[model samples]
Target: MVWAGMCAAIDHLRTHKNGKLIIFEKGGGFGGTWRDNVFPGCCCDVYSNLYSFSFEQNPDWTHIYPNQEELLAYLTAVAQKYDLYKYVRFNTAVDEARWNENKKQWDVTVVVNGGKDSEYGSGYTVTSDFLISCVGQLNIPKYPHIAGSDSFEGKIMHSARWDWSYPLDGKNIAVVGTGATAAQIVPEVAKVADHLTVLQRAPAWVIPRHDSIISEWRKSLLRHVQPARQWFRAESMKARESFHEAVTQAESAKAKQMREITLAHMHKQLPDRPDLWKIFTPSYSPGCKRSVLSDDYYPTFLRDNVTLETRTISRITKKGILFQGQESETEFDLIVLATGFETFDYMHPLKVFGRNGRSLTEIWHGLPRAYKGVTIEDVPNFGMLFGPNTNLTHNSLILVIEAQSRYINALVDAVLDVKAHGKHLSLIPKLEVIESYNLDLQKTLKKTSFADPNCNSWWKNSEGIITNNWSGTAVDYQNLVSDVIWEDYEIEETDGSETFVLRRKASTHIGRVNEETHLSTSTLRSAFVKCRSFLNWFCYSWNSQVDTQYEQVLKLSSDSEYNKPSRRLET
Candidate 1:
């Protein structure tokens, strides 16, 4: 677990009887994207009420869409509230995780930077029964393919890695790429910059959002009344689901109306600058590219000091940026490449070795496909969050992540049962299962806006396969991951000796255990509400063996080693 996605995975695992969670964050602190992306006016597109862990919802958001600082503070508070910092090893980056067939464990390598001492300066290895890749799709930032990015004499920076020390109060700035990050940065920079030039390769549809502050009374209602908070959250989720047409059906009447709504705003804002309107209007479908929501992004273009460049970029010179086939160049004191992340790379910057010494990157060959976008065929005992085709265009990604973590924990519990049986086990999804699933997935995604060929986005891979997002609504993904179909996996059992128990379900001598250690079925079921039926949700009759076994599992989690919180950094 490296970033926000992994932080969530860590949170889920800690609650279960799963093994110890050692979080290796490459940064000095947690919060992932919220911690790293500190560009001017950078904020979440989704409403704050819904953009959080379902287990722990915050009712104190000042704005509907919280700013970077507020989002980060919220995440930090979440980590503190959960006591997650103690288990975290900050400044430690995980390099590779290889599955050991003999030990049936994952051998992980990590390089530690800025640790307490030189003991871990050269890095070390750790082994665990399960491996989860929570390194999200947006971890690595993508830079523009300019000829002289490194050679540029001026201050150059990426939106993800904003350089705050460099002053931009009265300097001429060039912001590249008209994406989400650029959309927010351009407005704030133009406020004080002498001249701000926005470089646009493609235009995205801009929707109006009433991103106003939440009043004290409303915040109090959300905080004091539980039903009110739930109602608000439910309505916000429903609003996201209402975008089904704009995201999936471009030719539909609703999609057209949605398009007109954005154009109406543009018509009202850019009446005097019709040339700019033509340049800003997108020829592609409304949902082909990610739609931007802002109250001021369009109006900021009307400022006298702000300029929008719609031409192709040729290269970057020592002084400024040069345009294609144009002799003239725009001089700037600083440049911010608001270009997004390398999403098509999928699980890039991390090496994962699965069955038969096959690397995950080599298996996909730069293309990612998964069973339900959570499980893979070759990667035994390994799971990932926000994996291929799991990103959502309509609902908050937090919902998808919640579903995924629940499903993953279900698998982890299954593995834990096998470990308790004094057996080495490995569960990998069947190839036929994933192939069939992906075949239907590709067919379904073809009709969605993510697969639109008119505009380019990181949503699709080089093969034109929509690998970055889920085609269905958030609720659909929730139902799909609600159950863990055991038959879909190929389970291997080795007793650590020459003997092998192949394709065997976890045997606990069901219905037989000492009566003295028995716990009631109702009591066991109530113990773990989140993992309700953790021991056995499949079997109809409650077994005494499972009851005792479940008690042992609970005991493991409640034990001093697991229950005792490590030394955490106080907020």
Candidate 2:
């Protein structure tokens, strides 16, 4: 859906004006995550309004939680609506993007149809001013490392790579990991499978989805009187935003209430087994992990045909799975792994070389850092939509993506301005700025639900640092990206100069002068002299970068313009 919207925007820029856009997809089609995950009972966890692009709202959503197929259809419809098909080149994967400092363009190398050995054959290179990576987090499917995984006689598959050709009717199925995919799959397969075993590491906190079909009249009302639908969406979004604040804020009443509600739901569902409840209930607080919504997931577990196993698996033998304590091994006709994807790797199979021949991997070796989670230093004319620390466990990710799109567009505008003026410019955030931002982010992350040691989730890396998730509310992020701070970056202009010289004023404060007069160099010296008598000598270093003219302006003014503080800035 995101790629389709991006293409649509490009198309709008094209025929309506003289714009160029080329979309490359590794797969045969352009649905992104929707095209990849074809597992049974796969549906969106977020509400239809929040999940969809704000620019394109589907009032005609068949179910409250639209299935993958319906979502893919919506994307297709969106593509057709904006005539974006012409811009898309399917069956092409990006191999590398090298930044050309001289030309100020990205030299992109793409492997076409898996190279010469495959159908399309050979590789090609394309250069463009701007490069946008729309490949999302959930595109790749993860398979668990198990003994005899390859040696299994029966069919084995990841939930994302479901084989429709092999039927599941009356088969003895063993599903590993009861995450979102397993939650949906269990209900669907329970009806058909003779016996199903669910291997769960830890039970998820499930909320009621309350999914239902939209009536024709409701659709009509939504189509004509769209404000009504908009109002509903607004209210829903407001509630979600409030929830985000409640979760982030320490020991809030709203957070307590949300926790109580989740606990109540869990108790209501599993009244019989306290042991199961103890295992299922999270040690950490709610909202730490991605909150799952499903009415059928708990009820599916109650089915007589299905059995839930919390036992730790020793290994996967050729016949079946072996539990740590169990004497007997559980055999299965088929096995499905619902392990999620490696979301940390933003653009897999795509090698990016920035200025000074630095790979993105080398830059972000330990921790993923980006300026405002969108733009990275040294990677000229490249912006990521839904980049590092932008993924939200609460609320909508689409909101973040939209904000990123706006930032990218603004960046493009900045680049165009440079081009039109015939000025050689490079926009890269300062190293100090990015480092400070990351430090602040780490401070806030330490206090969040994700930092809870009791819980182990995919949101954190091996070091238990959350590389995903925004530290604050969506509104905060919106305000941060709404306007670009030119001072935060260095904009260099090169007119065949022997060496590039930065033309921005240094950010240092000199000594203050009197309230009435501007600060002259003599006055600054006198102020520093006075300060040295009382305070430490190192205080003078703080004002070293302030030029005489700017210092004079600061001295003349009441310092109100510079220090009219509002809220403290978050990292």
Candidate 3:
């Protein structure tokens, strides 16, 4: 069901299907972003209960908001539990993937890094029936375009690639951004740095975080009581869903309330420092850029050793950074670039060719778009997880990933079904379907806060197109991808067949996309969301007989071949 978000959808597919699977990971281990981003104070903004897989809830979390180490540990444990490591090739990268039209398979070239028994850069080729790209958008660290950055003699570090061996006990440090990553790093760095200068390009909306350690009693209760954990998970989902309109609808009442709360949070944290308040207040709307959640970030500026620099940087000298009009360059022992990531770049450096050798990079043209944020029009038997328009601003992305997994599984099922009938078929989304879906998606995104034009963030591309975030709530996204509509795809049968056959599948969700402004239906929609599970259970209890009768009617109308006893049981 759609309600069971993050329930090992991919693992379910692996266990059920009898096929060879290989995972090529560039990193040393299983955790993707969590394994890479190990900067100080790197913790998740989402609550711990909701950030995890629904099927495997960990009751042993120390804090409500988990740090990078804890998250990595959790992911590693989950991987071990599922035995995913056996299928993974550590330190191996995908160099190129091309669709073979004749074989209807993907020819993938991979590079494996040197190990104890292997050479430095050995490469090989592998072929697969389907290829799924899980290389997320935020893997690449983005350094600022400052002149003479290479000339700097001081030690430099990026947040995504942190240097743990370097000591920061009393070093002069300069942080180069005020985004979410910088906010997390600045506070931790200020505790040990002799003098810390923060370079702020723009201020983000800051909010208070009520994080606390989970008590032993509470942990015991969670481990012993299954319903308690489920309830906590649901409550977390509900709370995040309530704030969906706040981010999507700028002029919404919830948005206004959110701004007030954020302002109050800043004032409360740095009460005596009204001068610093002006420097911290965002000129743009709350959701224009990402709104940061922290109780420690704002107060870190109040430290005697810290300085906030909001001037334009001209260049990087051998010693340190030079401001636009300042007389002298600021000297620092170490420089940390908390400059975020290249979020618009998805599956970069991995060249992919689809039908007719059409390049994926050329098709995207610096702006990536996908059919329902998973598949493309010409890319047959291929899919991506956490692709364009699949990021969430108000809730956990685990939910969205689960939904995409299910949707991909549905597509795979369709292909397998066709194969069971002794035929070869390629499933690709229709061009018209892609056009219609993205048209409505862009139209809806124009009115959201992500398109505020006053500020530019990673949520959009360089062209000011909002390509990262979804247009609706996480629940809305879950509903949109609940079922795959066969009519929206062009099923090309490579086998010599006189006519194409149609499959009759009952759809629980259809035409759920192309939604108008979510603000208009806020009240009615929220009520339905709150009571949906209960309502679904109640309806099923009362209508089981009627549903069975309806299924019998559908079976009677189907082809006699499909109506056989074995097919009926399978259906």
Candidate 4:
């Protein structure tokens, strides 16, 4: 599912130019995550107002946090408004995108017509001069490697691929993982299921979210009073701005205060279950992992049928999961794996080949970095929307995506300008610029508590290097790329001629003629009179009013004395 970021980029490019945009939607249609993730109680972690594109806001959002179906419908509406469906080739999955340096275009390999009618037919190649990859970071699911996990005969489901046909009522269900996905699923399932066992690996820094229904009157005010929406969005953005510091401050006063608040919340929810409250206290600092937001997740442990298990798994059988130290093995009718997506894995499942056939993924080696999180110096004419170092803790993804889109649009125009001037352009960012930028980024992050040695989170790679999040705020990114640093780029002329020509020799117009030599005296006046009458008649007809100007011209033209030019319109 392609989200608003890619949609806005395509719309901008298409509106500015008349070129056809061929969207390779791997899924059946648009909606990206909203269409694919339909688990019970699925809702956006981000507020609904800021989640949408800036240009196309959905005032009719049902709640502060919209559910999956509402967000999906909003995406579908944006697609229809821009007539984006005509350009989309649905059910076409891209295998590899190769940059053709010789042809100066991208050669894409895709599997088209994968629905029932065509039966997932053969592969074909399509090419484009420029490529924008919006294949987002959160699609692939990660399964746990428990011994005999697959040997179970009962129904198994991933959170991303929920099995809706299986009912939870009167069923003993086992839920795996306690990240963001499991937090939402546990509360909803415990309310209906006969019994629920939540298997958790580590505790998350869970916080309370003030998410409530956006009343009809408020939605009405926001719809009609446009500033109300803008004001609300501004307030929401300002509220989240300081959270990044709170999470990154380690055991500092701010971090300690946040930890205290969270502990208090947990205690309030689990007043009788001090053991459950202790289970939630994390060994690492806050913001080590992306924090979860929900009101009912902690209170779920109070339910009589809910069980929170934090033991290490020994193995799995058809009956259920076996604990490491305990001999009693639990059995369940169904198992739901809320194992999260590969968030740190950028552009997974799609291999990209850039300049000289070098694999872009091979260069990163599971740790991706880019200049401004969009441009890789080695890769020319290729860009990404939500690339590495772009995930946010205290800002909107849509805001960052728009900033990247606007900046990348400038790069796209720069490439087009080079071609329009009869030159082949090859842009490779200078090596020092990228090095200096990343160095400063790492330096900034190291001082934060998130960079503490004890903190092990998805924000970092296997080598203990922070790879997923931005070192600064989203506003900092917006200010950094507000203008394209053309000087930092190595723009070479591929034809071996020269760099861009700045100044040319002076020149002047040579062809000239006197108006009197080519035209007669009566001819000019007669033409002016005829033009005046025609314009007058046209203006009146266009305004849906009648005029006698053309009739007067006809009467004057027929007169014997009217062969001479009329003097009235001479000026």
Highest lDDT: give the candidate number. Answer: 3
TM-score to native of every candidate shown: 0.85, 0.83, 0.86, 0.84
Candidate 2: tens digits of C-alpha lDDT, residues 231-324: 4455345445556644554365555665666677777887786776787776666666666777777767778899988888888777888889
Report the Cα lDDT for residue 420, model 3: 65
Clashing pairs in 4: 1-32, 248-449
lDDT by residue for model 1 over 4-28, one digit each (tens)? Answer: 4554555565665345677777888
lDDT of candidate model 3 versus the reference: 0.76
TM-score winner among the candidates? 3
* Cα TM-score of candidate 1: 0.85
- Displacement of residue 405 (Cα, Å) in model 2 is 0.3
The clash count for each model shown is 0, 2, 0, 2
- What is the lDDT, from 0 to 100, of the residue 116 in candidate 4? 76
TM-score of 2: 0.83
Query: Which candidate, 3 or 4, would have the higher TM-score against the true structure?
Result: 3
Candidate lDDT scores, in order, read: 0.74, 0.69, 0.76, 0.72
Minimum summed lDDT over a 10-residue window in model 1 is located at 508-517
Please, what are the lDDT tens digits per residue for candidate 3 over residues 62-174? 98789989988998888777666667777888999999999877899998875841375488899877777888878889988889989999899999999999999899999
Error of 1 at 193 (Å): 0.9
> lDDT by residue for model 4 over 396-456, one digit each (tens)?
7887777777777666666676777877666666768878888888888877765766656
